[model samples]
Target: MRFLYSVAWWLALPLVLGRLWWRGRKEPGYRQHMAERFGFYGVRATNMPLIWVHAVSVGETRAAEPLIDALLRAYPAHGILLTHMTATGRETGRALFGKYGARVVQSFLPYDTGWMVGRFLRHFAPRLCVLMETEVWPNVMAQCARHGVPVVLANARLSQRSLAKARRLSALMMEAARRLTCVAAQTEADAVRIRQLGAPDVQVTGSIKFDVTPPSQMIAQGAMLRARIGPRKVLLCASTREGEETLILDALGGIDLGNSMVVIVPRHPQRFDEVASMIESRGYTLQRRSALGDKVVAPAVQILLGDSMGEMFAYYEACDVAFIGGSLLPLGGQNLIEACAVGKPVLIGPHTFNFSTVSDDAIEAGAARRVNDAQAMIDGACKLLRDDSERMRMGQQALAFARQHRGATARTMALLGPLIR
Candidate 1:
């Protein structure tokens, strides 16, 4: 199975490169790091007892923060190598760990071909390896196993959509799963699925995202941004996907915004200009976060576009209500935990299969509400905007819900400490 999988990947090399090239048209970072995918990193090589982690993208990179912090403290003598597949993840790692200088090394993870994976493993010589979330690559696992390196899958979850895909590739993924030293799952459901998929050591360690605290500087920035927003009811349509933004714009156009401000923060930075144009074409007065610089939102502007990156927490802090995107479409929803952590009431669409457990629990816990469509979302937002008492109650519930789910990091550390020791 491993041999066949490697052969298939080798055959698909052209298509993969083509896709990267296509994506690079929008995100230049994809084109700039083409050599890294082949394991051709010319950075300073180091052998300081490395503790390497592979976080695939921005979401996983952010979720791995608590574990990264734990790894740093648990073995102060060891240097950390943070590897990422996307440029955004690498940037996020730098933003999170840039202060460490030589103590933290950020690099791109090579593609999952045998030789590329082998080169990555050989170069890093990681004492301990951690993969964040659903990255079960066969060649990578096979290479790590051959090098006698123990790999741990931390903060992992498997939705039904993902599980169905896994089932089709069960043989390869099972081999990958068996190579793991241990699996730290986010929920019991995840544990059960992983066990059934052939992971030998699966434990429900919850989600490390619950342990993440908003940065203090970001909160201060949010306060300043709120001051600029000028006492208007702020509604954040955060991490919105492609089609979702159009729906949000139409919703805003139909509604009576009055003194309320709608902030549309698209999920991908590449789409910032596209969304900004959409806002302008819709005939609403727009104020971009990037252009705002030192200026405040003028009273004439009804839509404030969040065109920056790594500032979701600030956006959440500045808003009265947050409508998490992706849920409105079938994209499985973005993470809502951050908004709730900051004491903001959240509204998600009906399509939350990606975060079904978290969304269900949040709704049950009174931190969030589920709306069916754009109209419902608009209605929900407008209702919350006017009903201060209801929003306050939901915000309090959101805070408490977040607090109640906060021990995942500690529990994960307990399970992983022995392996590292």
Candidate 2:
């Protein structure tokens, strides 16, 4: 199966590059780092010990923030090699670790083939390797085992749907799972799923994202934004996926948002313009975040497009209610924790299997509410908007819930203590 997978990868190489090109039409960063994907890149600061971390995309990259900071503090003498598969992830990594400069290196992780994996391992000579979330590449794990490298899957999670899919490739995934030195799973459910897949060791360390701290700048920005928007109620549609925005807009059309403004923030940066186009095409008057820099929002603005990057915390702070996207479209819900962390009442769509446990717990804890679709979301948000006491009560509950979920970072560090040397 490994050999066949490698051959399939080779065959699909052109298609991979073609897909990048297709996406590059909207996001040019996709075309920037071509050679790095083929395991050909320079390594600086080779004099120090190296720790390699693989975070595939934006969500994983952000989730990895606490772990990376912990590693930096734990091994001050060691240099860190951060590997990413997406342009936004790479950009985020650089922004997050740019201060470290040579101490923190960012590169594209090669495809999962024996030679490519071998070259990547040989180039970095990482002492400890960590993979974020649920990214498991059979060939890469096998290579790590062959090289006697300790690999830890940190903050790991596997939804039931993913577990069923993993079972189809059971032969391959079972071997990969067994090779991991330890699986630091997010929850007991995920740990159970991972163990059933043949991971030799799995530990429930909670969720690292629960430890994420919103920056003070973002909070201040949010307050400033709230002032600009006047006394209008802000309903944040955060980290929305492709089809979810249309649904949210349709729901908005149905509701009477006399003094309420809907803020639509797409999950991917590439979809900003597309989302803006979608809003305009739907006959809604909107304003972009960038355009509102120094100007007060026009009273006619019905929708605010959060087209800027790295300001999610600000958006959360600026809004009275938050409706996390991705849930409405079966793409799994965006991280509701961020909104909750900022003490905002949250709403999620029904298709939240990707974050099932968290979403369910939030709903049960009175920190959040679940809706079936865009109309339901708008209805729920409007109900909360009309009742200040209910929104305020939910917001307080969300902040407390978020605070209670901390300490995962310390727990995960302890779980991987032996491998840190």
Candidate 3:
């Protein structure tokens, strides 16, 4: 099966490269660093021992921030090698870790083939491989095993749907799971699901995301943005996926918003213009965050399009109520923890299989409310907007819930200590 999978990858190589090139039309980052994807890199290997972390994209990359900081502090003698698959992830790494200079190096993880991964392992010669949340590539795991490198799946999670999918590739997945030195899970449910897939040493270490501190600068910026927007109630629709925007817009149309404003930040940056068009086509006056600058938002603007990147905390801080997107359509859901962390009332839609445990717990803890559909989402947001006492109550609960979940990074560090030594 592994051989067949490798063969399939070889066969699909051209289409994959072609797709990358095609996607580069919209996201030019895909075109840059073409050699790195094939395990070729310009970065020279240093004599210092390195800890390699693979965070595939934005959410994973963000989740990795606290862990990366911990790793840097715990293993001062060792440099950190941050690997990402997406250009955005690479860019994010630069933005987050550029200050570390040569101490932290960024690269694209080569395509998941034995040959490619082997080259990556040889080049980095990392002391350990730490994969952030659901990045279990069979070839990468196999290569690390062959190279005798310890592999830890950090901040790991396995939803039932994902487990079922992994079960379909059990032969390969089991092999990969068994190779993992340790699996640090977000919740017990995640540990159970991961253990079911044959990971030998699965441990619940809570969620590292809970440990992410909202930057003080971002909070101040949010305050400035909020001041600029005047006293109108702000409803933030954050990390909204492709199709959810339309449903949200249509739902907002029926609501008597009066002086309230809706801020929609899409999940992917490439869709900024696409979402901008959607807002205008609906006849809603829109203002892009990028265009706002130091100017106050005009009263005529009913919608604020959060097209900028790396400012989610600012969005969370600026809003009175937040509706986490992706849940509205069957796309799991974006992280609500960030919103909760900033002490904002959160509204989410029905589907949240990706973040099932956290979502359910948030609802139970009174940090969030689950709405049935887009209409209910808007209605819930409006209701919260109107009821200051209830809204403030939920916000306080959110802050408390966030505070209660701290120290995952410390626990995770404790688990990794022995492995690294």
Candidate 4:
């Protein structure tokens, strides 16, 4: 099965490369580092021991922030080799870790073929591999095991849907899961699922996302942005996926927003223009976030399209109520922890299986409310916007909930410390 999987990957290589090139039309970052995807990098390797971290995209990259910081602090002599799959993740890495200079190196992870991964292992010679969330690749794991690099699946999660999919490829996925030296899961449920997949060492370390301290600068920017937008209440639809935007726009059509403005930040930057077109076609006056450089948002603008990147925290802070996207259409929902961290009232849709535990816990804690559909999401958001007391109560609960979940990084470090040494 492993051999067949590798063969399938080899056969699909052309299509994969073609897709990257095709996607580069919208996100040119895919085109820029073509060589890196094939295990080629420009940076020279150093004698300093490297700790390689694989964060597949923006959310994973952001979630890895606290762990990465902890790693740097714990091992001052070691350097971090942060690898990502998306251009946005790489850009976000630069924005987050550029201050560290040469101490932190960023690169696109090689395609998960044995040869490619082998070349990557040879180049970095990292002592440990930290995979944030669910980034399991059979070839990568096999290559790392062969190269004597211990792999840790940190901040990991597995939904029932994902588990079913993995079980369908169990022969390959099970082998990969067994290659993991340890798994630090977000919840007991996550640990149980990971254990069922054959991870040898699984521990519940809560969510490291709770440990991500919103930067002071981002908070200040949010305040300034809110001021520029005047006194109108802001409803942020954050990290929305492809099809969810259409549902949200349709829902908006039925509601009279009154004094509140909607800010929709799509999950993928490539869809900014596409979503902007959708909003305009719905007859709503829209303002692109990128266009509002030091200018106030006009009151006539009913929708603010958050097209800019690396400013999610600011958007959360600027909004009175937030609806986490991707759930409206069964896309497993994007992270709501960021909004809760900012102490904003959160409204999510029904399909949050990806973050089932956290979402349920949030609702239980009064930090969030789950809606059945887009219309319900809008209704929930509008209600919160209208009721200041209710909104503030939820916001405070969100803050408290976020605070209560802190220390996952420390707990994770405790489990990983011996392995690192």
Candidate 5:
């Protein structure tokens, strides 16, 4: 299986490079780090027993925060090594783990090739490796297994589509899964799916993300922002992507809600400028969060361009309604739980495969509304805005729903305690 995995890696190298090149066209940092990963540059670390955690991007990194903190507290002697597959993930991890940078090292994960994985393993010498969510890299797993490192898939999930693909290549996936010490999945369905894909000792530990508690600073900031934004209808476009922003802006323009404000926050901080430009081109007076100069909300703006990081929770507090992005155009949607956590009425588009379970739960609980298209989003937002009573009711429902779903992190941590220790 290892030999076959190596062959698969060789065969897929060209396609991988090509995709990296394409992504580099939009994100230069991605290409830069991809090179570093393959070249094995700046891979060494201080001499200490290391625990490596691999989170693919920003969302995964955020989900891993509680687990990382717990690991640090539980094993203060062990050094932490965090690896991300995306540039944004690295940035977010650095920001989130700033004070602990000395103990927690954030870097790009090496490409999933035998040599690169071996180089990473040799440098880090991690006693335990935790792969957040479903970021399963065959070569990396194989190398960790070969080095006798205990690798656990923490907060793991396997969608039906992914499971089907893995089932077709059952031999390879099963071989990799066998090397994993344990698989802590997000749900029973996910655990079943993973077991079918060759993973051993699978356990349903729920989702660590559900345990995320918004920082107190964010709560205070949200309060101040709400006071400033006042009664004017505010629609928060959270974690919007490329084409989604245009559609959202167009919807906002068509809506007849008076004295309304729209806040657009792109998922990637790198796209702040582009999103700001898009807002300007659409003829909406844009006020950037940075330009507000300590103001939580600018009164002289129709569109508040949230171009900052680590402030989504703060913004959510100020918003009366939220349109969770990424789902508008089949990108599997961004997490809607953030808005719900703040008691904000949530809205989403038709596509939400990535967070299907959460989305379904929110909808069933009457905490979220799903729209068919841009026009429906506009109508939904306007309707939600006008009906303050309904809005408040939904917001309450959302907060309750979020609270009820909490404790997944504790469950996951309990499962990870033995392996990490």
Candidate 6:
């Protein structure tokens, strides 16, 4: 099976390179990082026992943060080597954990070719490796197995589409799955999927993201922002992507939110300038968060363009209502869990395949509302704004729902004990 998998990968290398090139044409950051990884730039390991972590992007890195903290607490002597596949992920890591530069090292993961994988492993020599979410690279896993490094899948998830693909290539996937020492899945369905792919010790350890508690500073920052906004209705569009912002602005215009403010936070910081241009072209008076300096909200601003990073939770606190982005278009939506965690009245669109289970649960618990289109989103936002009582009620429900979902981190930590030691 391993031989066949390697042979298949060799045969498909050209097609993979072509697809990456096509994607890189539109994503400058992707192109830049691909060059860095392939060129083996800045790839090194400190001389210490290391625990390697692989997270593809910002969301996965955030999801694995609590666990990373836990691991560091448990093994103070061990160092951490974090690898990301995208430039945004690398930037976020530096922003979030750069303070621990002495202990935690961040870099782009090498490509999945056997030579690159061997070089990466030979340098790091990690005691244990943790792969966050659903990033399963056959060559990487096989190399870890060869090196006798215990590999675990932490906070693992397998969407239906992924499961279907895995089933189609069960033999190859099974070989990779067998190389994993253990699988800690987000849901029972995910565990079942891993089992189908021949993971021997698959377990449903729940999602660590639910266990995250917002920092006090973030809470205080939110309070300060609310005081500055001073009774004006604030609609926060968090983690919005391309095309969604235009629709959201159109919806806001329809509602005619007199003096109310709309805050737009694009998912990637690199798109700040692009999003800012779009906001100006739409004829909305804009005040950038960076340019505002000490002022929470600019004095005569109609639109607040969030052009900074690491302050999403604080922004969530400042708003009365939040429209979770990516759902309006078809990007599988950003995590609505953060909004729910903050107990903000939340809204989402129809497309949420990436977080389907959580979205459905939030809607069923009366913690969130799902809008069908741009018009519906405007109507929903207006309705929520007008009815303060209903808004507060949903907010309370959301907080309670998030509180009830807290034990996943503890469960996942317990599952990791045997493997890490």
> Each candidate's lDDT (Cα)?
0.89, 0.89, 0.93, 0.92, 0.83, 0.82
The C-alpha TM-scores of every prediction are: 0.97, 0.98, 0.99, 0.98, 0.90, 0.90
TM-score of 6: 0.90
For 1-421, candidate 5 gives per-residue lDDT tens digits of 7677788877988888898788787677677766557736564656668889998898999889888888888888987889998877887898888878578977788777888889878777888999998888788888887888889899887777777788788787877888888988887878888888767799887777767788888989877777767778888889998899888878777665577888888998778889889889978778888787656465667888888877889999888899999988978888888788888999999998778888888999999999999779878888888898999999999999989888777776677778764
lDDT of 1 by residue, 1-421 (tens): 8888888889999999999899889888788868888887776555578888889889998998888888788888888899888877887888888887888988888878999989888777887788888887889889989998889998989898888888898888888888999999988888888888899899998888989998999999999999998989999999999999888877777788987989999988989999999889989899999999878889999999999988989999999999999998899998999999999999999999878888999999999999999889998999999999999999999999999999888888887778673
lDDT of 6: 0.82
Per-residue lDDT of model 4, residues 316-385, tens digit only = 9999999999898878988889999999989999999999999999999999999999888888888889
lDDT at residue 93 of model 4 (Cα atoms): 93
Over 4 Å off in model 5, which ranges? 1-36, 39-45, 227-230, 295-300
Q: Could you give the C-alpha RMSD of every candidate to the true structure, in order shown?
A: 1.3, 1.1, 0.9, 1.0, 2.7, 3.0
Q: Residue by residue across 161-205, what tens digits does model 2's lDDT show?
A: 999999998888888888999999988999999999998889999
Using TM-score, rank the candidates from best to worst. 3, 4, 2, 1, 5, 6
Scored against the true structure, residue 49 in model 2 reaches a CA lDDT of: 77
Residue-level error in angstroms, candidate 1, position 166: 0.6
Once fitted onto the true fold, the runs of candidate 2 whose alpha carbons sit more than 4 angstroms away are: none
Clashing pairs in 1: none
Which TM-score value belongs to model 5? 0.90
